[model samples]
Target: MSKQPIYLAFSTQKGGAGKTALTVLVASYLHYVKGYDVAVIDCDYPQHSIAEMRDRDLKLALEDDHYKRMAYEQFTRLDKKAYPVIESSTEKAIDDADRITEQADFDIVFFDLPGTVNNPSVIKALTNMDYIFAPISADRLVLESTLRYMVVINDVIKKTGVTTIKGTYMVWNMVDGREKSELYGVYEQVIAELGFEVVKTFIPNSLRFRRELTETHKGVFRSTLFPPERSQLKGSNIDALADEILELIKLNGNG
Candidate 1:
């Protein structure tokens, strides 16, 4: 039987919207926590943040003992399983994806697409995906770009009969629940009116995410320097979001 891998395409026509960050987080969680053999396709050519982050983390793991220890401890608490293997590929064609899928032996393949709808290669890649996750922040410009991308995806689905596009979702990244942000209500209303699914979990704006990049060579962070309280809480939140995403996948019969 042919191996059917779960294809997740992360795209938004808006950069600096946490697309790469969330892609790495989800790929890490699935590999470390769920024990899935995952591979990341870096479709975003110029700024391959996902690939860069993975490379930095790997180098730190090899050179810094303290960082390695910290990373091991964190992974232990999160999954106690094998660490996810992340790699970079700049394949811009459907045939290229098929070749990668055949050779990588991955159960889940994620495409880190560029933040634009005009790329023909990206559109070709999206055609082969089982899930298209568009992360949108509570910003006017970002929202406008994301909505335009969604419209393009809708048209593609209509033309190609690929139901895998599922729907566009607004992930409340860098969100502060305490304050009443005007864009939050407006975006939520717009999403609902357009019949899109809004993920229940929100990724709050915190320094912890930025700190995840600064661990020692051993993947260990200095507990005294950066207390574990916030990291632990953020880890829990990420775990919840992963679960919610999995639920969405299952609901669409893709998981």
Candidate 2:
């Protein structure tokens, strides 16, 4: 059996790295696909992107005929309710998440944090995570920022000794397969030397990333109803990445 109420965060010190997107992707898979009880805490106080996405997903689940039917078909056999969406102050999101896990029958709690470490509140929130999975790109600035962010928080953990953070791992996001970049090779080397383990499953940059909810948005969630083989072609390697993450968590005894 899997562990109960594992708290995870998808964060980075740099913005526009698909933090919100991946949070919802894995949340959707865990709840709708793998049939686990899940909750999401949108801690981006200003943006509330995760909260908006959750509302969008709920609307689709309630209003779209085909989507509602698919959701019911998947959820009918389970005892869990529809996933909950929470909006919290950046300063209190971690404590709020702990309360949610303690009070709810959730298997996991996913936190969507803002893309900066300048705030003292955010640093405290980072120490609350049982695991932190950051999305990284080929950009030098982003790589540097994320590495620094990890080291800073790890130091906090060492100093405070008040966290379940086994370690932080980076996921390769927004890769363009048609063209190979020398920058990525260099980034990989530096990331390895920095002791950051980049996962093997890399997500390709795709149009499906932008589309959402309605027929027009064309977001990747629409494809979740498709068969597994078809969803694989839709350019979100999220499920594969989720599997790798689950294995790592279990092996680390955080599961």
Candidate 3:
């Protein structure tokens, strides 16, 4: 039997909350490292960040000997093509994803949706997701905005029982190592009061998280075509994050 493709997004209503970053990393991790069939629907229209990155990655891999050789070795070993990134709008995202699956079966199709829920089409797409992982930070404004967003998603969308959404989780991103433990404890209590679960793996704040395919950088930390090199990923907690997401999906009986 063909398994149903899981639809997921790393989302929050707050801008600069690391939604797009997490989407690319986790999608790459699942596709390259874990050997899952993955595809990305870049629905953050006008930007199409992931799609653009894919283009940049391809160009760099062609021009730079370091990246070119790495790509060659990876493709030779894995014998799998880089997962496709489809440029789409929020209104047509679900339809585009459905069409992609019909062409090539994917284990998961990640959507990089816009950071606002004001539009009905965006809400409609959210309702179609099997899971949504909202990345939160230690900042006061980020926390407040994220909590508010989760309330709407939980009370308005998931509770309707008319949607495919199984869970909406909180993932701690860009965490400062020097922050007091008490602060996070209080935040956790608030999150629990709001009735949302957080992913166990907290991503530490690091410059490596911001690294992209660049002309000067010899090592790749983030790419749409390949997983972050193991050395670059050392302290990011992304591998653990991906594993936890899969476990949660399985617990929900979708894996």
lDDT of all the models against the reference?
0.64, 0.74, 0.89
Q: Give lDDT tens digits, candidate 1, residues 1-255.
A: 156677787677787777777776776766655556566777677766666666676676657787667667866675543333334333553555566677656667778887666766666677777787777777778777887787788776535785566545667777766454776877789888876667887777765555554543222221211122333545436667777877776632233
| Candidate 2 TM-score to native | 0.85
TM-score of each: 0.78, 0.85, 0.95
lDDT of 1 at 175: 79
Better of 2 and 3 by lDDT: 3
Regions of candidate 3 where Cα sits further than 4 Å from its true position: 178-180, 251-255
**Residue 182 of model 2: what lDDT?**
82
lDDT of 2: 0.74
Clashing pairs in 2: 211-217, 211-218, 211-219, 212-217, 212-219
Best-performing candidate as measured by lDDT: 3
lDDT string for model 2 (7-60, tens) is 888888788898887887777776766666778898897879867766777777
